[model samples]
Structure formats: structure tokens, C-alpha cells
Target: MSNLVTMTIASEAFLLLSFIIIILSTKNPKRNVLWVILFIIGAAPHLYLAIDHVTNDYMDANIGLGLAFMFTWVYSVAAFIIAIILLVKKKRDNNISQEQ
Candidate 1:
């Protein structure tokens, strides 16, 4: 019932929703870019949380906090990377289709 717990749950939910959107978009070529945008939007909270934690000295040696922080940080970075790759591939595919 704490703020941290709420935020953590919300962040995880968003990330999961983003993943689902990305997976569903793969089958619907026209919506790929839109899904990527949705994924970024979903990931925004975790990204913000990770940056805030880094800037505010929230990451300490406490095992639980450290693990949570690391998980959020890694998930945010991985999501960003995956989104970027998907966006680029979507653009490339669009261009290829246009050329044909």
C-alpha cells in the first residue's frame, strides 16, 4: 500500500502491456509504428522511475531495494532498445513496400 509498491506494480503492468502490444503489432503490419509508440508510452513511467532513482541516490546496497532498482533499470533499457529496433525495422519495411 506504499507509494513505491504502487509505482512498481504500475510500471510492471505497463511494461507487460507494451510487450503485448509489440507482439500483437507484429501480425498487423500497418500498426507497427503505432504499437512502438504505445510501447514507449508504456515504458515512460519505469524510465522515469529509474532515472529518478539514479539521480536521487535511492539505489543502496540493501539487497531488496538494489534488486528492484536493477530490475527496473534493466527493463527500461531493454524495452527502449527493443522499441528502437522495432521502429527502425518498421520504417525499413515501409520503405521497402513503398518501393515495390
Candidate 2:
């Protein structure tokens, strides 16, 4: 198996694990942010490898790896957007509830 494949698997696993952690968390803003940060960190290694491999075309790689890297980046961005939306919604809900 190629290193790219390994990195892709690891990246996906970490992303999934992060989602699970976020879902299981008890709706704490601080904790949720921490988890998202950790998830991003976990994803960094894969993203780096993907970029390096794609940019340099190193290690006799093919275009498939490039596609995977692009997909991973897209997923990361989507995850961030979703997290932010959720956090904002939670804050708004909290504020409304408190005022009432």
C-alpha cells in the first residue's frame, strides 16, 4: 500500500472520530471548540501529505491521489463551516433561553 493511501485512511478515520466526539459532547461551547480544533489538527497530517504529493508529484504518484487530496480539503472546509454554524446556533439559543 502507498503512503498516500495510508494517509487518506488515517485522515478519514480522524475526521469521523472527531464528528463522533462532537456529537457525544454535552453541548459545551468550550469543549466543542476544543474538539473541532483537535479534529483539524488530526486532519493536518493527511492534508500536508496530500498537498506535498500533489504539488511535487512525488513518489511516482498518480492523479487519483491528487483527487483524494482535493476531496479531503473540501471535506475539511465543509466541516469547519458546519461547526461554526452549529456553534452560532447554540449561542443564539442559549441567549434567547436566558432572556426568557
Candidate 3:
């Protein structure tokens, strides 16, 4: 296997794995299946693009490959930020309800 293909697979797998780890480790009672589905859908395209890169089997990929990697980064960051926001919001809401 080409180095580029190996690298592409590693990075995408890592991103997917880390996200799943965080979701499983920190189980939030308020967060529903919708968030999981949203992340899976959002990640699908990015991962699909990565497959294209892997098939190329070249060390130096085209500029568009960079864009696909960017997509993965953006998706992961947005998912993480949105998850944190949701978790915090739920925590605050629960606290307020308990106090009242």
C-alpha cells in the first residue's frame, strides 16, 4: 500500500475513533440519537472523499484532496463544539430545574 493511502486511512480512522470514544465515554442523558445520526451523516461525505484519495495511491495528491481533508477537520470541530455546547446547556437546564 502507498504511504499516502496509509496516511489517509489512519487520519480518518483516528478522527472517527476519537469522536466515537468521546460519545461513548461521556454519556449524556439528555443527548438523543439525533446527534449521533447527525454526526454519522456529516462524516460520511468527508470519509467518502478520503476513499478517493486512498485509491489514487500517490504521495502528492491534488489540491482537491486537501479540501476533502479540510472537510473532515471542519466536520469534526463543529461536531465537538456542538456537542460541548449541548452538554453544557443540558447541564445548566438540569441544575436550574433542580434548584427550582
Whose lDDT is greatest here?
Answer: 3
Which regions in candidate 2 have their CA more than 4 angstroms from the true location? Answer: 1-10, 17-59
| TM-score of every candidate | 0.49, 0.48, 0.59
lDDT by residue for model 1 over 1-100, one digit each (tens)? 2566666667676576546645653657767677667666655655565556645654455354446556665775676567667767877988999999
Give lDDT for model 2. 0.64
How high is the CA lDDT of each candidate model? 0.62, 0.64, 0.66
User: Compared to the true structure, candidate 3 yields what TM-score?
Assistant: 0.59
Residue 5's lDDT within candidate 2 is: 63
The residue-by-residue lDDT of candidate 2 on 1-100, one tens digit each, is: 4875676776687466546645553376668677667666656756676666656745664665566566666676666566567767777988999999
lDDT of 3 by residue, 1-100 (tens): 4765776676667566546645654556456465567667766766676677666666774677677667777776776666566567768878999999
Query: Cα lDDT for residue 30, model 2?
Result: 68
Question: Where does model 3 exceed 4 Å of error?
Answer: 1-37, 58-60
Better of 1 and 3 by lDDT: 3
Number of the top-ranking candidate, with TM-score as the measure: 3
